[model samples]
Target chain A: MDFTGIVVVAGNYGSGKTETAINLAAACRKTGMAVNIADLDLVNPYFRTREARIPLEALGIKVILPDRQYHFADLPILSPAVADILRQQSDLTILDAGGDDVGVTVLAALASVLKDKSVRMLQVINVFRPFTNDVAGCIKIQQEIEASAKLHITGLVSNANLLDETTPEHIYRGYDLVQKVAAQTGLPVEFITAGQKVLPLLDMHRFSCPVLPIDRKLLPPWKRI
Target chain B: MAKVLMKGNEAIGEAAIRAGCKNYFAYPITPQSEVAEYLVKRLPEEGGVFLQGESEVAVGYMIFGAAGAGERVMTTSSSPGISLMSEALSYIAAAQCPAVFVNIVRGGPGLGGILPSQGDYFQATKGGGHGDYHLLVMAPDGVQEAVEMTMLAFTLAEKYRGPVMIMGDGLIGQMMEPVEFPDDLKTEPTNKDDWATNGMDTRKSKKRNLVKSLFLDPAALNDNNLALKAKYEQMKKEEVRFELYNSDTDYQVLITSYGTMSRVCRTAIDMLKEEGIEVAMLRPKTLFPFPEKAVFDAAAKDSCKAVISIEMSMGQMVEDVERCVKGQRPVEFYGECGGDIPSPEKIIDIIKGLL
Candidate 1:
């Protein structure tokens, strides 16, 4: 569960990147690793890592963002603290890179800094999303994120979910899609994520990688994991 | 078709295409911008037209132009963008053209935060634009309902020959859920040859079709208003759709809600049922007709003590709920806004306080 340096997560819009990033950070934190997560989802106005900041910070994990004034403004203002996180380097610095190439463009500015650091850029693939519904589509998203982020994706996270209605079938198919993408792209499948309810019913043998239990944090007030 | 996991915004875009609507013109705005993004690629692939207008104002006119020309047209926008299109909506309604407008409303009044809020209830239910007009508004509670409503909006727009709006909160535009596109809901565009100025030669007719909202003379304007009122009356009589939850037996508090807020109230009602407390909910699918009789009957139940309006705004829908209950029971209002959706627990607490 422990990772060195930074783990940047990026994918298409609505691909569960924020949830994956937050869960990944929490998993690392549970393993007694120092975790710092940066909220870089400027393209999305709702369901950002900042919404989970209170809980994440309460868990002793640092949540990085721009100044307090620009907290909820939905501006593409990447804070200097993001660079400092890359340089400061926690045991696991999970940079929740935004959705699509448009959102990942902010990470391009940190290309120079990423070169000197131990960076593991991970692409989250949700076969349920329109653009990334297949291997080709997933690969296209990976390429777009890499091109805009100016970094190569070293791993993939299978985050197939249908919010509240997710099932074990979705997780299995998601893993199958991620495996296909990994086989096509020659990248490692880092982990597969599922909501806590689905995790118990999933056939663990179906997945070759670690399983991350997603505790939804960026949900509306009425929703819960 | 098998159900697929889809975001509300993207599902709405696909619903429009499946419903035989090919023309989509929109400007990018938060929450609802995904609809434009999805259609920008998929529309052309279906041999349809997709245009990004310079602004919401221009986008609104594009819809009016296409709709007036007898084409099935749609545009999706957030609160501020919808406000910009309000003038064109009035024009389209006045001209008696069928146009579907989806307002994935964000927190509002003035460039409010981009989060779920039912603040646009008043704007959508009442005419956002000026001059006596009402856009047949439908408020969907979930992503699946959002898709269904988006598809139904097209047909309702054509049938009424006016603007139809699917008013949803930012959450409806952002959330993900499993949805199925019912093949039965796919409709062929109605024949608009009689009233459309789609070129008389195309319809093989000699009479010229005139489409305009301006009547110049006071008497003519009054007549047009009367005609519009007649159509609205027909809609109210035939298209008042609503769902009653937990009202079969008996309930002390009757909750009047719609869209995302209704879903929350439903969760609260179920949780309270576990605690031996009875609470019923009436969710309005069509906001225009308001389901007045349903609300009235539900409130008139002997077990019903008070009617409460639960919403994500500062009590916008309470006005309609109050009008519907007609003082049969004491009407109460509880709401939160600026992206704050009251939780099931908060609603439970509020309902318990009433008991």
Candidate 2:
């Protein structure tokens, strides 16, 4: 089987990290691969992989979250059970890392297990976030997260958005900012995610790799509209 | 029949297949994801539908939808995911939809640790979700019970037109032990087509079976709840499962425990016995509609001095044990929270103190 390795999604707060993770997992599933998603977003818990579990299960994709006692507003403690899933060779496993450096601490426990595996740790950049508004700031946040996790960032996900009202121009600016940060950090720009409506308007030729589409399912069911 | 060492999580998925459960919907949480991963491939091979739900909230609804169709369906999660599922579990129960839900409990008041813990006993047995309802909860201690109970859960759910829960903990989900699925057992074909909303057929009469928890009138809602309570009372006669160990003598101490913690209690019982202490244990396999008669009988014993409730949480199942033993015996309790699995040695020590 062509193992797509483990996609570790890490980024600053409100960077749409979980959304990117979910949609990317969905994109992979659409290509006829077995996909298993682990909701490791220990940060702001309200919008995470677990929120999308039902639809994912409907698609024959597997989703892993914490148990019932673990609510949305708690620190993420990665279970060793997650390591067992990571070691499996058949499917593509997506780790939807929580927002911010503290949230990424959950992965620090897996440094040894991740050593030989095909793992891609990507840092998502949202220019709208407090500290990571600029290219240098994005790079700085990436270093802080990488230092804390003891893992290098392999790629950059440009998920620039303006909350419930993200426009094509905002996505373009976010992509440009991440492109520069990618150059400085020596990380590849893996994908640029645009709202489904903006997908047709953007120039796909400006970046390398695939331009993954982002649906609105990452939003809370009440906030979806 | 081939028997191999399997974890509680893997056993749940495997048993669902063995039970002829044709549809599975789930969101993975620690200690329980294996249930989902194991089924990802096995379900397709078994000619079943395996869906990775978008969220625990949605997975619960998906199970509700699939079960509503008269298909044998199941979903598994740990504590946090189970919390999200409580709403759906309630709806399924109120709707009398047949399905199986497995909760591999972990420690917590909030995001707690990821180790095995039975903190969800009250939520699970006393109706984790809203409304006046209860799920037919089966607490499995070992891998064999986990697999066997899950299969039984499917049958019981369909038989009662209600939901059944397989409540285990992280230790059970992760621990591996030998399991044997009965070869003579086969899944009975469901007559779901009689009521399932599997697209309209003009040949059938127009009888729409709406599975919802919503009831507009207070009187009707009370009636529904009372009817549900009656159903539970009837279930008490048909489904209360328990295992009595070392109870042949007039024991000075009676230990009531269930699930993974009960396995630890079993070892503790052996140690207590070795020390010339006569102790008896009643491990409840069915938590809800608890083994009341077995507990009452054990408490009525003149030799059984005290009842100590052993659990992984801070005295949750102890409530039910107390309710059963009533004032007939002094019920004591010992436990640890936040994903801590109490050792058999700890239980032995606790028992010694009671003596």
Candidate 3:
């Protein structure tokens, strides 16, 4: 009942950011609040918001993205129209920005519009992935992304695991590492996404910010729920 | 009841509230992001929901889920974001899930520059997503229309149990204008337990409702497509909106336009009229299920030598005008892309050249 504003899911490649984004939007919508997901992942072509457009649309949630262009790969095709939609005073607007420092450029253009808006830009870290395994490495990546996006990283989303074989212990270890990064960066640890099954195993009170139980759908057909 | 000055995007947020909408979800893009920002604080105070989705894809599904619950929900985005939402839009159309969507369009081909453009005409009017479905698309010309159409979008969407789109461009979203909130904005709250999944208790024990677009069998999908086409045909009878200016007079030329481009076209038409030239203008309020009859009547006689389609794109809307004319008169096009708005004087010169 304490619905506030949008929840942004962002991180480096292979961090399962998009999957987290989709699940978070779904969970909130299931609670009877209107939700929208934006596809700002202009880096990789595969597994984007456009792919989920039909299912989301059937549910009546608004999805925003760039039109597919075969001829050009790197045009500043980010539409200002998305900004227009964000200005609406009624709906909650979430921005699924692109991955990594380069992908976060989408937020730079929105500096003026997001000026006074209560926005939270969280950096998602995957400990299993290289270069972000340690607390210092995650903080560095977060700082670089913040600089590139011209926005502050508001919080942390610890989602460290090996796909399909993650354990509750893995979630706890990932949480500890992210807590260090959050302290080093002076950003709060917003949320940690544990597989729905793993949620019951982890102590619910250890972390600050909400703990979101996520259902994975981005993996191959055999791994998806 | 009071008139307030607001940008088009902000107006959409206010208008959605006026229409009794309690939930809104979207992701931030340009031009329309202000709408999301505005609603973040306002919706909570009004006892509503405001959330910024993770991505356009997730934002769209959020809308889908909320509308299935029978809450008056809405979302806003730009051309590219709308492109992302098109798949969801197609499903909403087929499943007859009523909701409102506002697109503040900008230029695009890949990530086309973030300027105003009408390039999405084909996508908006002729179906952007896969599947044989047509959404009821309304194009607002000014801030007032943007607000009014958003309010009306909710009503029409619920009336048909399908998605409604308010398609405008950055010009409308950024412009400031005066507006009057209608005193009588809400009607009796109709229960949609028949299809909406608000709660099981809302309906008597019967069968569970599933709002889905999946039909493994080709025959079932074909039937659904045919049924959608039939509904579109019926909508043609019920939903053709337009505004005619100087059409009553003996016009020498016809101007066709919509949204912000149409407003510029109006300026040129007025200039030409001041010079004792008899020229008229027709603005399409409903971009989809376009006002074909109005177009035909405006270009009725051979007395009108030519028709001109003015827009923000290079010439997207011109294609529709050409179809409407069908060799009845010469049709021409003029536009400025990448947010470059064509001045009225430039449009006037183009009109003079056409004459």
The candidate maximizing DockQ is 1
Which digits, one per residue and each the tens of the lDDT, describe model 2 over residues B1-355? Answer: 5344455677788888888887989886776776776788578887788888899999999999988777788899888998999998899888878988888887786877777788898888887788788888999877788878988887888878898888898777865455677653466546665656655573275667666778899998888788788889889998888999999977999999887777778877777788888889999999887998789899889998899888888999888888888789899999887554677777878888988
Cα lDDT tens digits for candidate 3, B1-355: 5344456787889889889899899998776776886688578878999988888888888888888878888999998899888888877787778889898887887667665678888888788987788889999998789988999999988887888989988778865555666654676347487778767766764767777788889999888778778878887999889999888888888999888888777777777788998888999898777888778778876679888888887888788788877778888888777666777778888888987
Task: Please give, for residues B129-223, the per-residue lDDT of candidate 1 as tens digits.
Answer: 99999999999988899988888898889899999999998888888888988884555556799899899889999999999988999999999
Per-candidate fnat, comma-separated: 0.56, 0.00, 0.00
Clashing pairs in 1: none
Better of 1 and 3 by DockQ: 1
Kindly report the docking quality category of candidate 3. incorrect
lDDT per residue (tens digit) for residues A1-225 in model 3: 233475566787556677777766776677777877777776543355666777766766778878655212334577655777667763455677776787888787877877878877778887765457788778777878888888887878888665546677777878889988877778777778888777778887776667778776553211214
Task: Name the 10 consecutive residues with the lowest summed lDDT in model 2 chain B.
Answer: B183-192
Candidate 3: Cα lDDT at B354: 81
- For this target, which candidate reaches the highest TM-score against the unseen true structure? 1
- List A-chain TM-scores for all predictions: 0.96, 0.91, 0.87
Among these predictions, the greatest lDDT belongs to 1
Decreasing lDDT order of the candidates: 1, 2, 3
- How does model 3 score on DockQ? 0.01
DockQ of each: 0.59, 0.02, 0.01
